[model samples]
Target: MFTAVFNSFESGMIYAIMALGVYLTFRILDFPDLTVEGSFVTGASVAAIMIVNGYSPIIATLAALGAGFLAGILTGLLHTKGKVNPLLSGILVMIALYSINLRIMGTSNIPLLSQKTLLTNIQDAWAKTGIDDVLNGLLTAIGLGDSLPKTWSILLMMLVITVLIQVGMSVFLKTEIGLAIRATGDNEAMVKSFSAHTGNMKVLGLAISNALVAFSGALIAQYNGFSDIGMGIGMIVIGLASVIIGEAIFGAKTIVRATLAVIGGSLIYHFVVTLALRVDFLQTGDVKLITALIVIGALLLPLITEGRKVKARKKKRLMELQFDHKSLEEGK
Candidate 1:
């Protein structure tokens, strides 16, 4: 059980990066950039292929970011310059990227189990520096050293990286350019009135959003030790689940708060999924159905609770009015 929770948190951090991208386009830019579905596999394929070819993992990952950036720009241009509908523009780019990712990978899948990826590199560094032994000893003292996973170091590394990215996003959203991008989402016409170029803001925002999504994909490929053509399918829905769950539970009234909420949502989503999978009656194929049910419940729960509260308040108001009317009749 401990091992399951540990693995879930590590995987959650990687998914949170992609979720942050979704939040940027969905909540901040108010743009439904479905490019995410393709860009995710683009990142994984780019990184996997490069690593298999002996390139540094860092370079491979950054190249994935660049690929996703271009994908997003294409979608943005289609909408802003070509006068294409936003949803259709995303679909076009997403469809195009399917072939592009295959070309980059040169196959439907790229295995990296034998390759030295970023995760392996970090583990190697820790072993060489003697930090691994020290941490292992500490864990053993707490009785977790025996039961925890060999890749336990990944959780700490990912937690640090995730926090850094979240802080960076929070800071960026407070900057003038970030403010412009956010304002464009809130009111494109009003931003244009201020002499700001809303089109450029949209393009920039989309580029950044997809870049983060790709970065997350690269990390995921390294962690999973392989990349598949279909790995990105249904990812957008998962990202939305994280965003909605996070905002609903954590309350996203500010940018900092919202970013924190996204990370928390990702963790919670994974934990719940892990726990649900342990049910004796459930099979592995039921994961998507579980995801769908979780999302439906997350979305409807708040509304249902709010509706009940509204009814309660209305009943209370009616009772007060009735009591006042009866007192008036008695006095008369």
Candidate 2:
């Protein structure tokens, strides 16, 4: 159970990065960018290919980030220059990326089981620096000696990355251009009235969004030791789930709080999925269905709660009216 939970946490943190990217386009820019599905695979494909070709893992990951940025740029151009609808522009880029990813990888899958990935290198350094021994001792002192997770080093690394990205995002959103992006989402006409190029803001917002998403993909490919072409299937839904779940649980009243909530939501989502898969009758293939149900539940929770509140108010009002009528009748 401990190992399972730990694994879930790691996966959650990685996917949280992608969720942050999704938040930018969906929540901030109000852009229905389906390019995420394709950009994610593009990141994995680029990183996997570069790693297989004996490039440094760091270089491969950076290359993947660049590739993802380009994919976002294409989608942006299609929407802004080609006069395509935002939704259709994303769809077109997504379709094109499927072929582009295939060409980059030269196959449908690439395995890095024996290759040196970023996580593997981190593990090696951890062992060399005696950090594992220190961690083991700390766990023993805490009566968790037997529960010491083997993935602790990797988990720590991911935690650091997640925190850095969150901080970066919080800071970025407060910048002048970031304010423009938010304004563009809230009211494009108002932003245009202020002399801001709404089109440029949309394109830049998407570029940043997809870049973060691809970065997540690169990390996931390395962490899992493989990158499959279909790995990005249903990614947009997952991202939305994370964002909605975070906002619902954390209350997005502020940017910093919202970003933290998104990360927390991702962790909760992974934990729920992990526990569900532990059921005896559940199969691995049911993950997508489970995700869909989770999203539905998250999306409907607020409405359900609000409905109950409304009913309670109405009941109270009715009782008060009845009491007033009784008082009038008694007086008469």
Per-candidate TM-scores read: 0.90, 0.91
- Tell me the tens digit of each residue's lDDT in model 1 across 266-293: 9999999999999989998898999999
Alpha-carbon runs more than 4 Å astray in model 1: 129-146, 305-332
lDDT of 2: 0.91
Relative to the true structure, candidate 2 reaches a TM of 0.91
* Clash totals for all candidate models: 0, 0
RMSD of each: 3.2, 3.4
Predicted candidate 2 versus true structure: per-residue lDDT over 1-332, tens digit per residue:
76788899999999999999999899989999999999999999999999999999999998888888888888988998888999999999999999999999999999989999988988988877788788779878988777777747888888899889999989998999989989999999999999999888988989989998999999999999999999999999989999999987787999999999889889989999999999989999999999999998989887888799899999999999999999999999
After superposing candidate 2 on the true structure, give the runs of residues whose Cα lies further than 4 Å from its correct spot.
137-147, 307-332
> Residue 140 error for model 2, in Å?
4.8
